[model samples]
Target chain A: MTGPRIALAVLWKDIRLDLRTRDRLGHMAVFSALVVVLLSIALPTPTAETRPWLPVLLWVVLLFASLLGLTRSLQTETEEGALAVLTLAPCDRGWVFLGKGAANLIALLGIEVWTAGLFSVFLGLAWGPALPEAIWAGLLGGVGLAALGTMLTTMATSARFREFLLPVLLFPLALPVLVIASRATAEALDGRSVPGLWWGALALYDWVFVVIPYLTFDYLLED
Target chain B: MSAVETQEVEKRYGPVRALRDVSFSVPEGTVTLVAGPNGAGKSTLLRILACLTRPTSGLIRILGRDPFRKDGPALRSELGWLGPEPGLYADLTVEENLAFVARLHGSDSGRVESVLEELGLAAMRHRRARTLSQGYRRRTGLARALLHQPRILLLDEPWNGLDEEASERLTKVLQRHRARGGTVLVAAHAVPAARELADQVLRLEQGVLRMLPGGPREETHG
Candidate 1:
């Protein structure tokens, strides 16, 4: 009905669709688990000896898996013509970006949870500075990833070779998130309570690049 | 209720002029049909009115608001659009798709069911949207656009995949919507066979617009 109201509705709709299919988010989980498995095989044993790298490993797995879900996020809307419908609503078009961004955050968070669980289980991991740091890093990293991923996804929707394009475009942009996530996570794994400067940087990136979609979304949706 | 007032509006796409010095006024509670040849700017005009794109230079107003500046959540509650795709969620069930938009507009409970029935999509309510025929898919888009009960309905090729019966049903619903003071701006190859449903006809060619009388529309029916 209103901005926030419709924003929530769009977010809910996107999540329901992705969650219902199981394939989209399912692929994200599977891809995430595979990464965890691979990391376990490559590095093997996640006792205190390997725990130092656990935070890095956790974020690496999540950054990659987030790709699978984000790429297909706007694919359905573009292919099905929902973008046009959304643009036609009396509300501003930015809500489509915001709504999709929120939905993406929810899905990415879901993938992260799965990846974290698998990492701890299969990698023999159990070490962190504090619960707050872990959650803060996760939320910060999750929000940044979703913001960057959602805009890139919208851009990819209108481009040629979208499947290839989304990954190429997303991987480079998400690199910063991975770097910050690794740093924040590394500090936590070492049991050294520290200021989350990486999270701050991540937040900075959100404000800059994520804002690109809103300012230009109308241009992108035009036929 | 005069819904749209555009004065000396000109739209150009980079080097190509989509619309040249175009202007028109559309009153509310009436169905204005737009017809044109290829690259004639039918879709371009629709985009401007929907506020998805801005004119290169001109003042265009819709229901007393500037669409370009008022967008997304602010504009969605009142505007309804059906473009070439009506792209419903391939993975979502028909009813779920309707409810998704319904819930967004805070009208989920009975809105989804009513629109589903109106579009004759009741039986396919539980079916995945991708599983439906082209006609049904189009209906879903139309249904979703109207799901919010918007004041202005900007539809592009809305009848692309509908059969006679479905077309008639859509026509009936539109008549009721128009009767209730809702404005309909349709971009199509030809006017709806229900000529009485049309209040005015506008044509575009080579970046210019020309008005066609109501009589020319009657010949379209025959």
Candidate 2:
């Protein structure tokens, strides 16, 4: 199979597995949504002045929730020893990373959408003209997060304490993505223009992560 | 040329060495049995040969190509590997799992059916792997490994969960594969069926590999 075809096959398998089990995506949606609801109840009602914190809260929730989806995606491979089969497939193993990242991009987008809706409902914030730009930022941010998450998660799979190690390794490497994404999001939510610098950082982070994983995925699979 | 060749292969995890200076070769059209006690590096050796694991320091050539090189994927395509874990997606049906793997190999649907029937798993094709018995699950992995018609087979414990009939079927399959000039490297216990089929027997203990004299039929593990 060609690279794209192999990647699509892997994506199809992941989608099929999720469809049948509903294990990872369900956990991600519920865990993230719960964070929003719990915070809404715990925090004081937001006014125009304090509402910028909502964007930060939203990114935080989505960030941690993404951890669950990312880890589980590779966890299934390790738990079932399917990683061997994937690495053995007649294609660049990076294709597996691409397929995984794509699947995660889809799942994270779903979580982000629901979380955004819930954020608006709970915080009583009006999206207004910022909605489109915010959506754009979120999409861009998702690509970077998904790409980085896919690579780090695979690295953590062979770790002794994968559960704890994944976050430690991911959170540090993910800081740049989180910082840029959150700032752009805050600017959009505050009805200010997002700087080109922020958007450029997000795009650059996404491209670097996507390319690095493709180049280095073979080493991660190697023993 | 040999289907598999390894020279001074060693694998290390932290301070522990799983394989040490392991070297062996399996020429074409023969079945080589790798016998070892648990934790004796059988799985690690097989993993290296299958290109799923790279040795810390060594040379490995599968089908005369270095699996660590750029053409590794193409080399892997010509090799079939079954690890100790069954290596299947439990949520997928037997047929779905087989079909998905076949597609990854760029094979058509017809190959899937033939493998299913060959393993006597045709009737259970639609059943989810999680619902099947252990034997059936192993058969599913075996079928997937064989579906692409690889030139070399690297199987780790192919008989561990199989029933007598299924074991017989696998033996026959190996015999046929060898008759057609395919190479097989099997890591297994000293089962009679596997022993009878092996042209060579290797024993591994404490990260060392030794060739047993008198071939598989006459060799006995201590």
Please list the C-alpha lDDT of all candidates, in the order they appear: 0.76, 0.86
Q: For each candidate, what TM-score against the reference? A: 0.86, 0.96
Candidate 1 local accuracy as lDDT?
Answer: 0.76
Give lDDT tens digits, candidate 1, residues A1-223: 4667667778888877776777678889888888878888888555666676777778877877888777667666776877765665445556777888888898888887788778778886554445567777788889888888887777777577888888788888788878887777767767777575666787888787668877776666664
- Chain A alone, TM-score per model: 0.90, 0.96
TM-score of candidate 2 versus the correct structure, residues matched by position: 0.96
Q: Which stretches of candidate 2 lie over 4 Å from their true place?
A: B212-222
**Model 1 stretches with alpha carbons more than 4 Å out:** A43-54, A92-96, A128-132, A203-223, B70-76, B190-196, B212-222
Report the lDDT tens digits of candidate 2 across residue range B1-222.
Answer: 988888899999779899988877778888988888999999988988888778899999887889899879889889999887778887889999888898888988899999999999999999988899989989999998999999999999999889999999999999999999998989888688878888888889888886543444555443
lDDT digits (tens) for residues A1-223 of candidate 2? 4778889998999888887788989999889778888998999989778888888888888889999998788777877578887888788888988998898898899899988888888877677888888888889989989999988888887788888988988888888877888778788878899998888888998999999999999988765
RMSD of each: 3.7, 1.9
Q: Please give the lDDT score at residue B24 for candidate 1.
A: 77
Residue B143 of candidate 2: its Cα lDDT? 95
Model 1, range B1-222, lDDT digits (tens) per residue? 468768778898779999987777778888878877878998888878776667899988778767666433455466787878775778888888787777666775788888888889899899888898989888888998899898888888777889988898888878889999998888888644534566777778887876543442332220
